[model samples]
Target: MAEYLKLGVKNEPAMSQASLGFVGRSVAVAVVEDISHNLDPNLFTALKDAALSTNPDESKQAVKAALAHGTHPEDIADFYIPALARDMGDLWCADQLSFAGVTIGVSRLQAMLRALGPNWASDNATTNENASILLIVPQDVYHTLGAIVLSSQLRRKGFSVKLFLGGKPEDIANHITRTKTDAVFISSSAGETLEKLRQIIEVIRGSSGATCPIVIGGSILDVQEIHDVTALTGADYATKLPDEALKLCGLQETEKKKISARNGT
Candidate 1:
């Protein structure tokens, strides 16, 4: 990652594995390391520039070049694309990019992910009911790139993911009542109020009969502390890591566990 992209983002101090419980922390660390190791910095720069360029075809050409270099489509969708989105968000925060610039960049990223094919989501779904999830972005929250990327991630993890973007609390609750959602993951932005989250979560709880686990994530988690979200929103858990959220809901098994079970070890 470029140092310039790190502007306005809070950096966490180093801590021992024992100081923080290692299980979830280790998983998050491994995820970061995996993306950093696989992503080509040069290609990332090109992709970022292309996505923000005036011509829409520039982004496609960049993605084509990435694929030609033998880059896995999933890697592009999961790691490269999300990193670009995050950078755009950080740039917007630092006043380096306007809201319009970030919006355009994110739209291009979404199109690029879609061009990667059905395999990015559906091919990996495996149609397991246990993996069914409802991903929500509360009404008035403008930061949707993270939610879109997360939906793709969850789908690629074999979860049947549904996105409810900017829906009213009553409507969101109605959908929850109709769907077989194993968990409800809400993606919120920084400017959104805690009272709004509380109200939405309250409605979702009523609709879900208080059985579904509601996990809040997105840029809100980046700016606000996790403990504060859980405390203020009546959420079951709070984290930006998809794996952690799913594990907390008892929906997703660890990769190690999945591999061991598959290998009969």
Candidate 2:
């Protein structure tokens, strides 16, 4: 067996055992590391110039060339493309990147996993044959990128999701009444919104008789906080990916045991 692995790029070596798979991971890492380390200072400058240039076709050509010459197409499509589109305020381009078969890179994979919540909920809905999921975001929390990504992931995973983005408390109550959803997901990008979220949970509980589980997630709910909030709301907190969240809500003993073991309990 070859002890030394030459990743697809010219001079990079495989950094981890997991990268040895014959798929794109090794090549992807090599390309990203190489470009990050050796690309000239002018590359990003050129890309920005192209993104901001007056001639649309020429600007796109320039950006494409920059991506093609220095970075793997997968990396560009997955990580760089979305980040660039976001930084540039071009959501249309970001949507294009999602559909462009961009293999999610390691750094961005965490966000992608976070987005998988709705999918897991949807799967649970179908399997039970009597349940559905309502994905809820607060009125003030405008960051729906995670939700949008998660919605798509859930759809791909064969779950139905009704996304109520930035809804008022009344709107959420009305949605729950109408849909009789199996689960509700509340996501916040900031910790400052925790009080507001707590209020919303209280309102939902008071009005809905605590019928459905309200799952909270995002950067705000780290490990300890997930448990605490779940206790506070009398709902559940999804500390892991969406699938894990769904399993927790459904109370699947085997899945719960597996998660416990993974968590070293």
Candidate 3:
């Protein structure tokens, strides 16, 4: 985990860019395939197009069809949904699409997620027994889809996560202590200026939960910004993506111990 922070946020690899044709392997394929074997081409394209569509009803039909055909909710959430976002980001940068379009796209995707609500929770018995993790959406921030995605991934990996969508620092601290949270995660946003990061960090530091490690990230933080934030704040670790956040917080690996114990290895 320390190694990842040291290396910092990576540009989407050269290989990933070349494989946009859906002809090869990448983190998306590897991660999504592990959860579901039914990677239907139609399902994949349906999700992609639905996220970019302007019409809510049409997008709903595509997302619903994918779910009805046995594409797992977790798969859609973690896999195809983020891909659409990235694609939108690229288009926006190139001025081919408006930011408003991207926002609408995500709203449509969220509709699919809301529709798939309960199935998103993990059924793993070990997860229910795991230590608590608090995912806080810090003050004044609205979108927390990144944190939500990490929470789902963590739960699937057998960690108990409590996502605090919005709250005061003292209240957040009280909840963390009452739950005996093992760690906490928070995110700014894609365009965060970090003008208030220091204040936000201080609030977390003053809390009873301050002793637990805090991992922070936002889309705006490039490799240099990540290092800068780490240097300027009480953050123990940083990453541009939530998967790395889980690794740095050391939650993603805990499930391995359960498997080893069951095998008596």
Candidate 4:
């Protein structure tokens, strides 16, 4: 973990324009395949089109259509948005959409995420707020909708989650030291960002100490082996599953909390 901080945030590879296509296509196929079964195919297409459209109300209407179709908001946020983000990335890589078009699409998706609900990022449903998690997304990461949705999911499960979109390693360390964090989750998207993860993990270990577990997730995990990421970054665990992450950190929720969250009680 000490190795993580030496390189710190300063060395994160800037996502050059040339590599954007590579990064986009690298993970898109897997993401598309993952959500194909869970989401309504028609609704997914509508959301993608709305996000890519210029009309501001188009995305809103798409979301409304989803709700009217009896789709849950959580499902839209968790499954659909991430899949759509990847589809947009794939489109950009295929030259079907200009860079500016993809950017607008991603921005609209983010706006829709915020509109999911007041508690999308924080749920008071669970009384166990003592267990907390720090969810981080390096500044270079392009798709953060997954991390945000994960935050909501974790909060619903009774964990107090603190999410950091992007920040310097020192800032991250300082925050970890200041807060009583049980686990640290760093989400990465591109292959070029792997080395930077090593640095960030090091910083997290440096400040939070070896006792606190670090788990890496996001699109990178979809394409890479779990062992590869953990071995490279010196993270305690690497997975996209929240339950596994919590278990690794020795903070898994009680069965009662889990049941309650599922029952929406």
Q: Write the per-residue lDDT of candidate 3 for residues 49-97, one digit (tens) a residue.
A: 6666545676778767877777777777777665555555565445454
lDDT of each: 0.71, 0.49, 0.58, 0.71
Pairs of colliding residues, candidate 4 = 4-199, 4-202
Q: Comparing candidate 2 with candidate 3, which one achieves the higher TM-score? A: 3
**Whose lDDT is greatest here?**
1
Q: Model 3: number of clashes?
A: 0
- Which regions in candidate 3 have their CA more than 4 angstroms from the true location? 1-45, 52-55, 68-72, 90-100, 117-128, 166-170, 193-195, 241-243, 259-265
| Top candidate by TM-score | 4
For each candidate, what TM-score against the reference? 0.77, 0.50, 0.68, 0.78
Report how far residue 11 has shifted in candidate 1, in Å.
Answer: 32
Write candidate 2's Cα lDDT for 1-265 as tens digits.
Answer: 1111111123344334332221221111101112343334465445444443333344456545765676543343334433433433332223322211222222233332233233432434343334456766677554455565555444444455777777888987776666666667776553334567778888777767788777876545543476666666555565536676677667344444655666899
lDDT of 4 by residue, 14-69 (tens): 55866574446332321223666787888887887777765778888889888887
Q: Candidate 4, 216: how far from true, in Å?
A: 1.3
Which residue ranges in model 1 land beyond 4 Å of their true spot?
1-37, 90-97, 119-126, 254-265
The TM-score ranking, best first, is 4, 1, 3, 2
